[model samples]
Target: ASRRDAAPTGDFHLPGWLDVPSMAVSRSTSRLRGPGPANVSTSGWTSTMHSLRVGILLGCLAFLCGTAGAGTPLLLAGSTVLYQRVLTQPGAAARATPGTAGGRLITALSRLYVYEREDLAGQAWLRVGTDAAGRNLLGWVPARDTLAWNQQLTLALTNPAGRERLILFRDWDALRSVLDAASPPAAGRALVQGIAAGGTDRRAVALEPETYVNLYERFYLLPILEIKDYSTAAGNPVRAVKVASVTLPEARGRTAPGSALADQGSAAEQLQSFKAAIVFVVDSSLSMGPYIDETRVAITHFYERIRTAGLLDKVAFGLVAFRAESANEATNEQLEYVAQVFAAPTQVLNGEDFLTRIAGLREAPVATDYFDEDPYAGVLAALEQPDWKDRFDARHIVLITDAGALDGTVNAPAGTVPVNNRAVPAVDSSTGLNAAAVQREAQRAGVALAVMHLQTPAARQAGNLARATAQYKDLARNAMTQQEAYFPIADGTRDRLRAALDTYAGDVIAQIERSTRGAATPFGPAARAPAEAPADAADDADQRARIQAIVASLGHAMQLAYLGERRQTAAPEVFEAWISDTDLADPGLRTVEVRVLMTRDQLSDLRDLVAQVIDTAQTDLDGANSTAAFYDRLASIAATFERDPEATGRRRAPELAQRDLLLDYLAGLPYKSDVLDLKKSDWTSWGLQRQADFVDRLRKKVLLYSRYYADTFGWVDIAQTDNPRNREAVYPIPLKDLP
Candidate 1:
């Protein structure tokens, strides 16, 4: 039943599992009374009722057994489902049912009949069996939390990384068809993920306490790159897990991904989507022969591997080949640099079209008198090309050059070698953008820029080579959101260089995933399909997207703030995942794709999440990762605020006052909001500024109240600041007395 074709697709319908006879007792296993209820005289009426009940019970059991497999054992779930248990022994420290950090579970048992039992703490305990490594094993489980003679069926899928993906279902026929069609991974197992019925909207699989003995809440994932998204609607949720473990041809390009929520479409469309603009920008000097050929081959290999994995729908390719202009060409200015577009960026994933386009690149028709080519010109041309898509899901630019940008400040590389005065500028050149402008444009356009220096053997010994590497490396960092974005792939060999390119092919997917993942839902990239917003919902959807984008932006900012305060120098994604999936340690975070914009209730929840993150950062600062410094900074700020003389005398900040008013409203104290005073026509009229003004007005109420009772008349103590803390005393202060 692990196959999708084997999964149930229709509405869940049980075949009379609970239908049982209710006959009067003819006999009893214990006590003096017979099988019927005690004190029943065997009268004609009683006999007739018994016959009907017996017949009904028999028919019910027969229906149930028909649906169930023959001789199948079953166990009753204990009172406490998702109860903690150790795989080792009864007294061992408990672990999650799925168990943290292990290979895929081969099989899950539906139920175990208790041949024997022990009573412990008013709960029935029974034994369950599991087979592993060719041996039968028995584990202890609490009995009777859930009771059903029928088995709870599940589909357990695993990725090549041994990460288990399981989905529980009452019935799903679609899943079975998907599984049957999928070709498994080269190494580990592969399984499909599906929507089921559960606490969450989708992720419908229900976890059985007896199966895991580890948890009641269930979570599952499907291999992202391997599976096809079954649904194509604008809002369908597609569950996915990172496929970083899957091997691909090496790549060296840098990747910068945009927000998952900002993507053009819903989760399913986004996952099925690929729109990227990658301009190779290769230096086409005579010395670049082997460099260009090998780079193209490496990329070809990468495409082949991804094609095998069914991920071509997620990528596009472009090319730019350049050469230094001859002395006769200097009249054309930038044209003297001789940079030209080899292939405009387009979706290569649709077919084998990219291979032919890339094969067309060759050495320039003429050679240059100078060592440096107009590398900057080549890069600028790539960014200016019109072939790139406007509404890209992700975008990247790969810069490949062998020589240094022309630097006017430094005398022509040891002279007499005929200085390439058409030097790349530190910033934008008079004719074109320098590294800074290129990077700034990339960042603004959400295009990641990667600089791959195809170095010659002499690159290390020359001062010019060092300068070029330094300049390009800084360019890479500027184009990316991460500090260690450059890959020093020691491109001294063909294999090493190919490996670097392969890194980009894989890392691009990874970086995109990190940037787009939501903070409070299933921890995968969240995106909307590229379809136009419906006319009826255009404004509502747009505003919703804006609010979510803001929340996600703040989430990113909070993580950065924590790292900055702590003086840490690590990739930001580390903390992002921590905040998004906080409960992964206890029970796994619910695996549901949350792509919709937050509603009013969800907005409140997002606020709560913000508060939790802030509070957690303040408390858990003593670890070795320099979180202690972050905590200390927070404490220092708090102390400073507390020590403020103005604060002591109730001269509170407007923001603080506003927060107090909002908190009160959230706590269910809905006084006629002063915010509604300047009533707007509708929510569309209430932009962010209006929302801010509302909070400020509400805050003014708090401040005015504070000044009257505490500062002006001394009606209440300063310590009793927030409203309702001392309601009776506050009321006695009088509306007339209030300032």
Candidate 2:
């Protein structure tokens, strides 16, 4: 019978080359009597023997056919018996012959167990199977919630002879291609291909069927997938791709300093220690409503920006508003108002909230008719808090108002400009020059004073107010200016303010960087080294000798005579007397009141003498002669004061003297014209040299006089003899610090 006949009714057929037919037999039995040996001849007997052999062959063929009917059961039993023998017996004793089909099949099955271990974070397991060609197959598995971008999957194929081959799929596309290539045809031997495909969620799809295989029994490392929000220039929605190992929160943390995991903890601690005490000097007067609205918007934006930058972790802000008097009030009322401090981190002020508050401010009844809109008084009040000095490192008193200063005192006036109107009084009786004194006090306490002037018309009309406002704006905008100087506000001041703030912050960060990572060691005691010279030793001997020679020449050659040719005099007795007499018996002779004693005529005489001395010194110094123009100028100045003590008060004698000394020193230098005529760029090349020479000459003269003063007064001369230091000291002292 054909193999087709042996095949089961539902079984599918193999190709022609693989078909094997089952044997079958037909049976019939009949008894025949055999003749006695006497009846057979020798030839007949031989023929009968041949016939008997043929008959036995025919019988054997019948038995084989019969057995073919029960072939399936016999084959199953034989296979079971062989399997038992191979498993139970020792490997050496039961070894199959080389090149045998059974031996090759056993070797191929054993080789399927050999596989390399994978050490990926999200790996599941390894699967093994066989293709239609009987080739071994392998694949990788993935864990739940895992998304790997551009992942490479590999397979190891081991043959019956124990030979191994590696097959790699570069990505999902490659993996799909490999599976398609290995797929079996419908009408052929079905080879087992082991692969299982599933995922934790709908968003993820495993490219390979073996992605769910769990290599680790109870542990798995989950892969992180990133979902990005992409937008167009107009902020419209755009497409997003799920990227592997790109976490959104982690990215955000990396971009912003305080948002990082490590920084967040520290930032929280810092926030706890941060306490802000802000005094907002808002302008609530009638003229400031519109400006106040805009300011509110700006301030709201500022708050929002701070919050977005994560600065709220270390900041707390407050407010204070001020306004003018009501029309019915007899006296100008300047309201002193404040907001209760909010201690927690809050969202930026909303526009509606700001507008509502501003509107309420406009409608609110006046608290005091005598207050008026005096920003100076409000400034003083804000800065005078008892605990203010200790509470904040960044104390800002922002004054947002129109006009400069006004009197809150009552006065009789209908249409008349009140005595206090637009007048920033230099002195206050009640507060004792309190406004000016407060400015000084704020500066001393290192409290920043920022004045945002909303006096639009006045600020625009007058250059004085504009200049003052500009300075104030600078101070308000720049924290560094607050530390070093004061800046006032004016029109077009926002950019300057922002730039100053940036510069100040940059400076602070730079200082931090330097202190943390500079050549100077931090948190250590002062490093001590042996001095180059003893403390009392004469340093720079040659320079000192030269200075001494110049001083001696100056002392000997110096003369003080009126330009009108009065007898040549020693550096005037009155000047010497003035220097020697410390006690100011005459009120006019006191340093603060010296200007009161001078006459106009004496000033004119002193001016002429100063001019002559400069000319003479120039002539002598130009020839490299032992001359001292610096001393001569100093003497000329002293003589002016001696001759007419009040000359500087009557006019600007000190200014004139400074201008002459600058001009004289310039003229005395070899490159005087070059120094004076230098453009801004030329300063890069010429400034250092000119400064060096000026400093040297000025230092010699200052030292000479300083030494003289020390000797005469019996005081120690601690002044530095360097060029820069001497030039700085040569300028006449300001009136406030003169005595």
Candidate 3:
């Protein structure tokens, strides 16, 4: 280090990587010592004094060398702004110029947008800045000290409590080799253990399992820079993706100078303080009197248990009653209310208060025109009426109904959007929400819906049971749990309904107990591994197990949320490392899930584009006798709709299939579209039925887009601009929901 700092005095040689020429060093040294003493006494003492002065100068140079890349500036190789971005590694410094010193110190895993690239003696250096536009220059950083991140695609890690700790390998081959082993799981365990024990192959592991936490409910994102697809030795497909772990800005600014949870209280105290809000949305027509009476009994008993456990403040209940609406105003009046909010969760201070508030709740005197009722309206009310985010971490709505939800029926006026199938105005419900819309709204509010469907004799006779089951399952589906939390009571017996409610309530209470005892982990003392039921297990056992699993999932989510808010748990800052999407312990379970970051404008554009395709297909396909005529009509329509009709001709695929017709946000996504890639030839090859199927798929996509656009809860203003129009405000949409 001392010799390198001397600036080539008396045949000093620099490292080849530094690429400093001898003449350049000489000129630099000469410039530094301008107009010094010309003559001096040639004595031993003078020589020693000169040597001491040189030593001081070299020491000062070494101090200056602390600035990374303090040498000749490398020539710029290119100036095009790179679409790809990068994250920094530890000790990475952005110098003022390529191979020159003194610039900003970037944090590990901090995102940087590159403006230019330069190579000096086989070392690549990137000129980066603060933003994608390259407006604010941050300076140059060596390519070796950064990780390439192109798509901005990120994965949210599932809870690691039940699963083995994710092993981040140094490269793809290391991960693949483990998966290819005769016993992949055993090999994976051995590799992890070897790394943990500091064996010879320790360098193969970039991060230990314990360094990462379950990012179930936090802003932390693990950006996937690269992805590899491969099959295991057993022919099971697996994906190994390279990810750059980051602790985002949102994770900062919590309690300072200590563990955030420690600042509040002890770990046990913080975990025990988990709160839950459960709202019962009931179908209360004339025939529901007995069920309503039983519901009251179940709640009263559950309240007693909660009070006994001293968790009165931790749990609260609200009620909503929904009935059917008809085209006739008189029918609606007779029904009294489509969805009446008896009590909001906020209004219930205690168990006594909850009961008192809903004392007047009862079944309506009149019945509806059909077996299907406005259950979605009741759910919408539950979601909209309460401040779920501020009040509770575990928010749930238990929908108790005997009949199916009102999706579509013959009795109605025309032109209303059909939910399941066939449009009708009256069935649109008072809230103007469909099943899909209701589910999106619930997600926005972070509320889970659990349906208790009583498949009554009447429902079976009317053939509404099947439709009700499908609709209720869709409504109650929990993404984290990967299953619907819908419970079907085949006999619709009051006693059975009461028993289901008891079990649901008891499971929730058990979760709260486990959480409070610092047993939120999968193998914690309070958490027992579920006993596998026999193949011929009773419906009751199945229902009980399902309820337990759903409640446990909900509890896990709540704990994660609590930890995120209270503890500020963050992902490990690994610059670049390879990790498998599936868990090592159980290959069937996913360790990470994909999400697409979309802006409101982009979603709206996608919705509009899909709607246009639907309109065009509906208008043109009906009149056209052949596929050729349909193609001609589609081309004409595209010319009429697009701003530059001539540009439409240049499109790779005609009309609806044109990529240019979609938003820029949709264009770069790592997904293939059924409609966007269609050519005239492809459409001609597809028979009439297949073509019609394509149109139908677009319509479904349009419906999904509408639901995604309507989701108000998920949009996050990352830029903090306060302006809604700013494109920086994005929502991390689940990839499955993408059209």
Model 1's alpha-carbon lDDT is 0.32
Candidate 3 residues 1-739, lDDT tens each? 0111211225332121111111111112111111111011010000101111000011111111112131221111221111435556555688877887656666554555556666677667777654444345567888776765544456766544345556777568878778889988788777656654545353254433321243323345577766777888988888788766554434433433353434566545666777777889998987899998888778777778888988877777778888876667787666766777787877776668778877978888777876678787677667766355576767788999988776533333223334333222234444434465456556545567788888788877777777777777777765443446778886788877887898887888777777667763542112212322223323777767767766776666545445545555554443456888886656766777776554544555445544554666655555433345455444433322221111122232234334343332233333322332446688877644456545554444454554444333334434311232321444555554443
Q: Which candidate model has the greater lDDT, 1 or 2? A: 1
Against the reference, the lDDT scores of all candidates come to 0.32, 0.26, 0.56
Q: 1 or 3, which is superior by TM-score? A: 3
Model 2 lDDT-worst window of ten: 37-46
lDDT top scorer = 3
Off by over 4 Å in 2: 1-278, 324-359, 363-372, 385-388, 407-435, 458-739
Query: Considering summed lDDT, which 10 consecutive residues are worst modelled in model 3?
Result: 38-47
What lDDT tens digits, residue by residue, belong to model 2 across residues 1-739? 0112211244333221112111111011211111000000000000101111000011111111111111111111222110000000011111122121222111100111111122244332212111111133222211111121111111111110100011111233322232233321210011111111111221112111110111011001111112233333333332222212111111111212232322333222322333333455555554555555555555555455445645443333444444433344333323323221111113214334434444444412444332234454345445544454444334556566544443222222223322232211121112222233334435334455645444344444533353334334333422112121222233424443333333323332222233223223111011211211123212234223322332222111110000001111011000000010000111111111111111123323333444444445444433422233344344334433422232233244434344553332222111112113433343234322232233233322322222212111111111111232221111111111111
TM-score, cand. 3: 0.69
By lDDT, the candidates rank as 3, 1, 2
Candidate 1, residues 637-682: lDDT per residue as tens digits? 2221211111111122223332332222112111111222222244
What stretches of model 1 exceed 4 Å from their correct place? 1-274, 330-337, 347-351, 414-430, 479-484, 489-491, 509-739
User: How far does residue 504 in candidate 1 sit from its true spot (Å)?
Assistant: 1.5
Model 1 RMSD in Å is 29.9
- Maximum-TM-score candidate: 3
Choose 2 or 3, whichever is better by lDDT. 3
